[model samples]
Target: MKANNKRDVNVSKFDTATKTIHVFVALCDNQYQGIVPVPKTIGNGQDPDNNLYWGCANGIRSYFKKSKEWKLLKTQKLDKIRMERLVFKHVSKNYYLVADAYDGQYIKKTTTDFLYSAAGLLKDTIKINKTTIGINGNAKMVAYIGHDGLMDFQLNENFSNADGKQRDAIILACISKKYFAPHLSQAKANPLLWTTGLMAPEAYTLHDALSSYIAGGTADQIRTKGAMAYTKFQKCSLKASKNLLVTGY
Candidate 1:
C-alpha cells in the first residue's frame, strides 16, 4: 500500500505452509543533504559530498545480488521509488527479502510520514498464520538502515503503532541505539542489534550480518560478524567498532 507521503511501500506474502521467512526492508532515501553536513571550513574539513548516503540502499542491493546465496527475483525502479525482491534457498531453508527504496524527497520533508510509512509497511507485511523463529513468533528480526537520526524527534513522535509482534531489530544509523531503540522497543519493536554512535551504514556489515543469520548465527554472533566486516572492508578504527551494540541477546 502507498503512504500519504506518496512513497510506495510493498510487501510480499509469507506462506506459513512453506515455512519461509519474509524480510521487509525499508530504505528511506538516497540523498545525503541532511545526513552529511557541509563543512564550514574548507581545507581541514571533510567533504560533505563524499558521503555514502546517496548509495547506501543501492550498495545493499548490489551486495545481496552479488552474493551466491541470494538470487535476485525482481526489480522495480521509478521516479520516486525503487524496489528489489530477492530470495535465498539452501537445503531445507528458504527466505524472501524485499527492499523498498525511496527517493531523496521523502527524507527532505518536514513530516515523519516516511517513518510512519515504513512502520505501516512492516506492520502490514510481516504476518504469521503459523509460527516461525525470527518474525512474528519468538525470533523475529527487523532492521532500519540509513540516515534518520537527525529526524529523531519526528520519528519518536510518529512511530507508535504496534501489532504485538516480537522482533529483534538492528538499526544501522548514527546513534541508533541511543535515539531510536527506546521508542522502537516501546512500540514492541525490540532491539537486538544497534549502534551507539555515528555510523556510515555501509552495506558490507549488513550483508555479513544477514549472511551469518542465514548460516544459523545468533543475534550476538551476527552483530560481531557485522562489526568485523565493517572493520575489514570499511577500514574503520577500533573506536568505531566499539559503537556496535546489542540488547536482550
Candidate 2:
C-alpha cells in the first residue's frame, strides 16, 4: 500500500505467486496497529472460478498485507502436499514408499517399476530410489489423498464433470469419504472436501463445526487423509501387471 493508505491489490494466486513469506520477516503498517496476515484460500474453481477478495473497513487488507514476521507460524501455513498420489499411485500400484521433498513427505516403491514411479514422484528430491514398507500394517488405517474437489462438493457434481471416464471415479470418491467416516467413525475428522481451499464460514462461531474439527482433529488416531493429509501411493505396485492409476479427484 502507498503512504495515503491506498494501494492496488490483485486477488489471485497467480497475482501473488511471487510473494513468499520468509522466515523471521514481517510486513507492518500503522492503521491497524499489529495486524496479522491471514493466508489467502487456495481456489477450487474447476479451471476458472473465484470467490471475492475484498477490503475490510479498517484497512483489514492493508494491515494484514503489510504485517508479516520472519518465521511462519504453525497452522499458519496449511495444506502442503496431498494424498491422491499415495492411494492411487503406490498402494494401488503395489509400489513401495520412498522419500519426496516437494510435499516434504514420501512416495512409494518396492520392485524396480514401483521404485521408478516413486523416483519420478520424488525425482527432484532423491537420487537413488531405495525404499519399501518393511513394517506390515492394516489397510484400514491407510489414507489416500485426493485432489481438491470441495468446490464441487454438492452431490450434483458427478463423475462426468471430472477429466476422466469419471463415472466409477466420482462414485468412488464419495463412497470413500462415506466409507471412512463411518468405518473409522471419523465423519468429523474428514479434512475439508478440498485441502486449504476455503476459509471458515466468515461469520460462524468457534463452537461451529469447523472449529471443533480443527481443534481435536477428525477422530481417528490413525485416520486416513484423502485430500491434504493423506499419503501418496500408486495402485499398480500391487498388481503383477501394469495398470493405470487414477489419483483421486
Candidate 3:
C-alpha cells in the first residue's frame, strides 16, 4: 500500500473510440522468483535486454515486433517496478496493444496491477496520435504473462469488481486457470484464455490468440487458436495443448 506517485492520464479529454489490449509481463528472474532456474544470462530480470520473458526471441516484445499483424508505435522507459512499456497498433483493426515489462523483483506488484485492471480498479490511459487508448481498467482485454506467483505467495485482499466493466482476461502462466479462477470470478472478468497445467508461457500463444480475437473470434475459438500455437511451437499434441489451454470456468 505504498503511495503511487504516478499519475493516470485524463481519459475523459481524449478519444475513446479505439479498443485496447493491455499485457503485463514479469521478467524471468532466477534469483528473485520462485521456480526452476533458467540460464543466468536470460534469467536476469533487471537486464531486460536479454531477459527470457521480455527480450528473448519468443518474448512478447520481440515476437510482437516481428508479427505481420502488429506495428510497433512507441517504446518508453518506465520506473523501477515497470521497467519498460511498448505500444502497438493492429494493422487491419482499430485496436491498440499496450504491454508493460515489469522487473522480475516486482512480480507481486505486476500481479496486483493485473488483478486491479481486471476488476476495473486501475484506470490508466495513453495517447497515440489523435486517439487516447485505455491501457488498464478501461481496456477491452487484460492479459498477464509470467510466472504463476500465486503458487509462491498468497494475496490477502480481494480483487472484487470496482466498476462492473466485465473485461476479458487472458492469463498466460502455469496453471493459471486454477490460481486465478477465484479472483477472476470476484473481479467479474470473463476468462478468455487460461492454463490448466504447467506450460511454457511463450509469446506465440498470445500472439495467435490475439490474432484470433482481432478476427472477432469467440472465447472458445480464441482458446483453440492459443492451443494450436502452443502445439505448433512446443511440439506437443494438439489434444494436450487443448487440455492445457482452456477457456471459461
Which tens-of-lDDT digit does each residue in 97-117 have in candidate 2?
A: 221111211111111111111
Error of 2 at 186 (Å): 20
Name the candidate, 1 or 3, with the larger TM-score value: 3
Return the top candidate by lDDT.
3
Q: Show the lowest summed lDDT stretch of 10 residues, model 3.
A: 1-10
Ranking by lDDT: 3, 1, 2
Candidate 3, residues 71-134: lDDT per residue as tens digits? 9999999898899999999998999999999999999999999998898777877788777778
Each candidate's TM vs. the true structure?
0.66, 0.17, 0.95
**Full-model lDDT for every candidate:** 0.49, 0.18, 0.90
- Residue 166, model 3: lDDT of 96
Highest TM-score: which candidate? 3
Clashing pairs in 3: none
Residue 13, candidate 3: Cα error in Å is 4.6
Error of 3 at 100 (Å): 0.2
lDDT of 2 at 231: 19
